[model samples]
Target: MAKADNIFNIRGRLGDFIFCQRNGKTYVKRYSGGFTKAATQNHPNIKVGQERFAQVSRYVKSLKQQLQPYLWRQKDGTFHNQLMATFLQIAKNETEKTFNELIHELDSYSSLSNKSLNKNSKIDPSTLLYDAKTNKLNLGIIPYELAVKYKGLFLEVATGWYGVNDGEIFLTESNRQYVKLDGQTKNEDQLVDFAPADDLDGQLPFVGLAVVYTDDATSESPHPVHTVMACFVETRNG
Candidate 1:
């Protein structure tokens, strides 16, 4: 007997058309008519052919409804369920804390006067001095997350050095580039500042505080590079 064709090539149509393969021979069953078996006697391995048919039938049943319109535009219910499941999993692992709770412990320290320099002082004297100079005091430590959420309030208080433009809060051109204020190009430095404008709402312009650091050197050389911290001292606008 001649060898049969592979069963993989047999295709099925929608509605009531049935397709099957035995050995290498193809067969079909139509809804309106009787079944038609292959003429060739070349039979495929019965076990493998039955398994292949079952697998294909399972795949076809799993497919979406054929007559549906714009399949891609429709929300996949299965996919949405999967996404929600993943979100719940993430929420379970995360720690939930209120902004006030996170920074409340630092409130006492943040309100202290910057003068009378003492280890027991609740606040840094320099910060108090700056507040006095600017006529503004650090209310408290803003939770990092809350600060980001209410960034508009902070931006209102910031100087023009920071502002939201084109959907991002960025430093102005004057402060855009990192400066080696301490004269160490190899080290890193950044400056940011912000203060409220004259408007009654007290919106702040973006300002950056400058950061300065020295690079680690291979030799134990005393590179006494220090950025003048005084530059950060707040000044009242005329």
Candidate 2:
């Protein structure tokens, strides 16, 4: 026996019904045979008008209760159920919105309520990084943007997984890769013949713009921390 989701019981009968507005009058009728016809005239039900929606308040209250425990894992990130976490957060955070409106933005599920569905349901937005008009990354234009944005900042133009020569001002292709030994690929920035100044941090300009994507652990740091990513590779072009 499957559960009846939206069915209503009227006059001791297990059937389906809907409330509708006709002209200026509101009435209730069976899901079928009640659209243009009335319960007394069309589907021959025992009741008519407004009473069809009597159970609606109870159903709405039940739905509210069912959603109470939604995404308990979201506020506490100890658990890893992605679906429940996302839906619960979305439902709770968007106070001005309703679940019905919020659900349209979600991918649908069946047989299981999404409230308890535990699956890897995440979307990465990397594709959205492209230029909307050209549908490409305009890498050529980024150099100027970098110079402007990082004009006053002290930046390590070169980053290394193995090691970096402290206070170096040059770079080379071999600098892109890393090695376990010190001074092997560690001295990448020495390849440049940068003009020396009294103060390298203030007088020297940054080599170019880059989009370094370090892990969030470094977010509190004034600059990026360990395990820097591929954006440094493009900085060489600047």
Q: Best by lDDT, which number? A: 1
- For residues 1-238, write the lDDT of model 1, one tens digit per residue: 2222554555555467656666557666665654345522234554444444443343223322220210112233353343234323332333263222222222322222222211221222242112323434331232222233322222111223222233332333322222222222222222233243343122222221212232211111121111111111233343
Please give the CA lDDT of all the candidate structures: 0.28, 0.28
Worst 10-residue lDDT window for candidate 2 reads: 121-130
lDDT for each residue of candidate 2 in 17-105, tens digit (9 for 90 to 100): 45544444445555554354443455424332222222323333443333222211122232223333444554456546545443333
Cα RMSD for candidate 2?
21.9
Q: Score candidate 1 by lDDT.
A: 0.28
TM-score for candidate 2, please give it. Answer: 0.18
TM-score of each: 0.19, 0.18
Superposed model 1: Cα runs more than 4 Å off:
1-196, 200-202, 205-207, 213-238
- Cα error, candidate 2, residue 142 (Å): 16
Q: After best superposition, candidate 1 residue 185: deviation in angstroms?
A: 27
Give residue 59's lDDT in candidate 2 (0 to 100): 30
lDDT of 2: 0.28
